[model samples]
Target chain A: MNWTIFHQQVFPIRHKLYRFALRITGSIHEAEDVVQEVLEKVWKTPADQSATIRNWEAWCMTLTRNRSLDKTRDRAQRRTAPIGQEAEYQTDGADPARQIEVQDLTGQVRRFMEDLPEKQRMVMHLRDIEELSYEEIAQVLDISLDQVKVNLHRARKAIRMQLQRVFAAEPVQTRNS
Target chain B: MKEQANIQALLDRYWEGETTLDEERQLKAFFSAGNIPEAYQAFAPYFQALQAEHAVQLPGNRQAVRMHRPLRWFRLAAAAVIAILLTAGVFWWTGGPAQQEQQALAPVMPPKIETPQPALTPSLEPAANPVAESQVPKKQTRKGTLRKTRSVAPEPAPEDTYEDPEAALAEIKAALALVSSKINRSKHTLEKGLQEVNHVDILHKKKKETDG
Candidate 1:
């Protein structure tokens, strides 16, 4: 998109892209890079300047997802690399006040999802946060529908266990005690 | 010994990657909609995410995406090109006038001197130098007369009213020497140009004679 339109229409979605990416990747810097890289890839080469993309969100997510996976692969390859080293974007600030913590179970669940495996985190995000389907996830991921199910189920089990632990640890208030 | 007691275990096995595709699809549908039993409610977002992922359509643009690159690049390129073109065009336009002036002036310079060379009888007129006299055509004589008649002031001084007429006369002598050097250079250039032009003319005439 042009700068004006990007500012007017698409820039508003940047935080959304950032948030969604952070939800999946669990690192603010990586998520920012994912969003930046996706945007760059979309607009880099003049050749094939336009594509037949019917959903910008889906297209962007697919690109971001693929890039994040690549980064994870590269990081895995370089086992000596530090986390978020030389990463461009840093949403987290020096002050603890900058940390966004919604005082609710959803926020708690999100934080819990952060502890999940990379693939599981993405699966959880794709299934829960983005509200995508097994078929769509498979398409976006270039995997089979059954693989999506396995991943999603595993992700759910982990999240479910974690949330249960978190809720149990917190003093619960019954509505009709 | 029916399997009702192991149903929970069977369901856990389904979630733990042992389920067949049909079984998974059943679970997907079962968890996708409606009350989504509290046990499954926590997993609902994942289910919704799958649907979102699937819905990832093409660049969902109806009125076509706007491009800013070419316009940005072109505006800059066009401005630069126009500036370069304008400067070049000015040079070209002004350059034509100088070429036309040279074309008009070059032909007239050599011919007037050579054609009138035979008309000077400077020895008969009591001139000092015979060789200079011979070279002095009527045009050269007239040019000398014109130079002398136009200004009788100390020649270089522009106004002969110099307190020391000797210094003024000396200045006039220096000016004459400079003018003579310039005239000699011009005469040499004219002669060379004539030689070249005559050579070309000869070749052209021969070609025409043969062709004719």
Candidate 2:
């Protein structure tokens, strides 16, 4: 991992690392900081040792996760407001009503994710959003293959149930109208 | 109707968390394609949101941003400082070259007998003449006995010369305590680094809140 190799092999995964950090930290600014810190740590690894790493992506992701979790833990200690309370993205150039609807939906999804247990949320983010393989997710999260499957299953099931409840309520509102 | 039935079955498996990656992709594609049947329209947003979230990338050239990161030199300096401290701590813990040399030389040194009286009495008892014991040169007899003992004794075990087991134990405990205290201090330094990294964000957020 000279600068060239770092740029090509390691740095390219910055978005994935950023997304994972963002998902864990639940604040874009904090997430960026986490990614920066992770990258710096990775950069500091001796070039020879880093070159021998079999899975650079997994290594970077694991570092990102540890750093993000540290920040989350600190935030917890400080007794701050729960993260991900605000929407993560802003809609642009859309009809005002449609934008509001999209934002609302995004908020609901974010809340659902934030409400999940830590492992489940992390596993879900890696699987669905980052599209990491089960093995990769396990490596990144430092858990067994079976634990990864179990967490992913629980997370998806929870999200499905919440979606069902929301959809179920929507029709009731329509019926009253 | 057949496609709808296929999706329904897939959705069931999806909810069960049994879908393969390709199957999940098919589900995402179906929901994201728009014009979903009214029955499934409510579920479309979940998939849409997944897509939208995936697209939320950092807003600048990552390489450039990283290169120009704030406190870049300071971070490097901090890392260098930590590396030096860790190396120094490890060297100090292992007691540097003097202790290492002492350990290396310990096995080569001769063993000592603290009480020779009892040791010589048993060997002397096996002698033929107790009356001639006084005539015998004690130094020669002791030297001969020591030779016999050395020849009969098994190889000396390394690190067996603790004068006081309890004191040795206390020394080990103290060394461990020192190592642990060093580790705790390092942990605090890392936590402080994390806090410093986050400080800028906190400041920006406060500024935004005040302006708003």
Candidate 3:
């Protein structure tokens, strides 16, 4: 890969790649390694292969996802890792009571997003957080557009349900007060 | 009030994943503006989380990205170590064997006649004694015979005939200083190479100039 192409096209979007990778891998160091590996892989792509890449950002994102998933799978195979370990974004205070006392509602929502199924989590992250278009999301994930929509819809519905459950008691407490 | 109603409608669509990016942005803006109405306060955290996620950048700076090329500094330091090893090897290879041979032969040879004077002599003195002067021709003849014999064997090594410990220490210090200077130069070159790699702004330079 051309250094010029890397610094211009791939370097600027590192944070997006990192967040996507972090969302998948759940470890900051692993995510960074995944991004680095992705960048190096992109950098080493032969000129002909690189020229075929119409969207460097999407290609980089795809690479990031694959690398992150591979790292995650390796981690799982090694340690029989729990899926819930991806809750890196969980609030520092683990207790729900402490969370409520701090009103760390956003942290709770982040944890809910973390608990989402892989497909749904990826789609929601690409759409809501990174703000990629539905087509770009599909392209990065190598999934059908319809699949992206379904996953995104399910992900959003799930998060909303969790949010409501957490806050459903809030109004009652307010009214009684 | 109309804006609040619009936001509420947008929130409903947002939860259903039907809101366009623009509409979602509108909801995000409204929530981030603070002072949410009591009705929509339950959903504020969701939008806040989205906003916070957007703001989360890759930690550190460009250097951290380069650090992904694991152990770049290690490679450079390793090269420096190899270079030092090579220099010391050359120093020993050029000087070691002959000196060892000379040390081995010291007991067999006459110290007074055959021992070579050190190059770094403490003082310039002439061989003025009559007895030594008389032996000069014989010394030359003996040296010539020794040279003929020595030619068939391996060349004798140069001697470190420094009689003063202070002078030897000074020489050692000088050699050490040279090695350290070379290592420092290599370090500077490595740093310069790192700086060169950081010229990642090549693509942005022109745009920045135009903007400036």
Candidate 4:
């Protein structure tokens, strides 16, 4: 679309797209690159063609997903550090102890997400973090509604189980102390 | 207690992937409000992480704004370059205007074809008969010869030729008209060739249809 409309409509969604790319690529810099590439692609498309797209946000998300996946593949060949190592969980204004706790929790959650299979991770991130509707998730991921539900279910179950294990260990550690 | 019960039920539905976004938001709100009971503390981090991730925005959309401005100019420059190259390529392919003019004039100034001169004494026999001396050469050259021969005749005096400017202008006009007609005749031949090609195409199509 024209610059005015893109700024108004499409540009506002860069955060969402960046988060999605970040979720996939794991590296903040790579995610930024992917988001920029996707935005450039959408910008390069003729206004008329982009105007015909029914859901520009979902379209941008889809582009982000594909580009991030490609970057992930390239990074895989290079065998870089696992995703989420660069994730900086903000703990604004908290006490130092609370901040460390929050950071540790954030790191654990990010690792849990990174450990998820691609589809499940994407479904969880889109639904929980990005707050997309099921239909929008399906549209962005190009999967069926049932597949989205199943994947989200599996992802949440995995995270829940991990949390439960950590919870179960807490009492033992307290008893030992 | 009732709120906890509601959250518990919502969490069940959420884990099952059946909660509406509103219900999910309700769950997030309850946990994020803090002072969670010991029973649900384990689940708080998951919701907290979601909030934390949501807070994670790209630092600057200003970068995107800046990027698009230069991108617009880049696209325009690319388009202009392509257009110029295409125009230049077509002109070069068709041989430019000067070459076209030379082609158009070629037929009017037919090249002089030299025949094998008969082995004879240099004679002034044909000089008295102006018609015999002025008769144009008749022996046609081979098809491939493109060389133009210089005239052996001495150049006419400029005064003799310019003496009647009106007559000279009329002669030039007549020569141009002859060249124009020859170009028209060549154009007609080209049209005929194109029609013949069309006829062949039509016949080929008909044969293909019949075979199909």
Per-residue alpha-carbon lDDT of model 3 for B1-212, expressed as tens digits? Answer: 99878887887788788888888888878876767888887777677677667755566633266523323544565566567656665655445767657655644554433434323232423464566556655765677456544532233443644679999799779877976777676666556655554453343444433432
Tens-digit lDDT track for model 4 on B23-45?
Answer: 99998887778777677877887
Error at A48, model 1, angstroms: 5.8
Candidate closest to the true structure, highest DockQ: 3
The superposed Cα distance between candidate 1 and the true structure at residue B51, in angstroms, equals: 17
Interface RMSD of each: 16.8, 11.1, 7.2, 11.5
Task: Using DockQ as the measure, name the better of candidate 2 and candidate 4.
Answer: 4
Model 2: colliding residue pairs: none
Error of 4 at B131 (Å): 99
In model 3, what lDDT does residue A30 have? 81
Q: What TM-score goes with each of the models?
A: 0.42, 0.58, 0.59, 0.59
Off by over 4 Å in 2: A82-101, A171-177, B61-63, B68-212
Candidate 1 chain A: 10-residue stretch with minimal lDDT:
A96-105
Candidate 1: tens digits of C-alpha lDDT, residues B104-176: 4543444433332334442444256666656555556577545433332222222234669798699779978
Candidate 1 runs further than 4 Å off: A1-17, A45-56, A80-108, A172-177, B1-68, B81-212
Candidate 2: clashing residue pairs, number: 0
* Cα error, candidate 4, residue B36 (Å): 1.1
lDDT of each: 0.53, 0.72, 0.71, 0.71
Give the deviation of candidate 4 from the true structure as CA RMSD.
Answer: 16.6
Instruction: Label model 1 with its docking quality class.
Output: incorrect
Q: After superposition, how far is residue A64 of candidate 4 from its true place, in Å?
A: 0.1
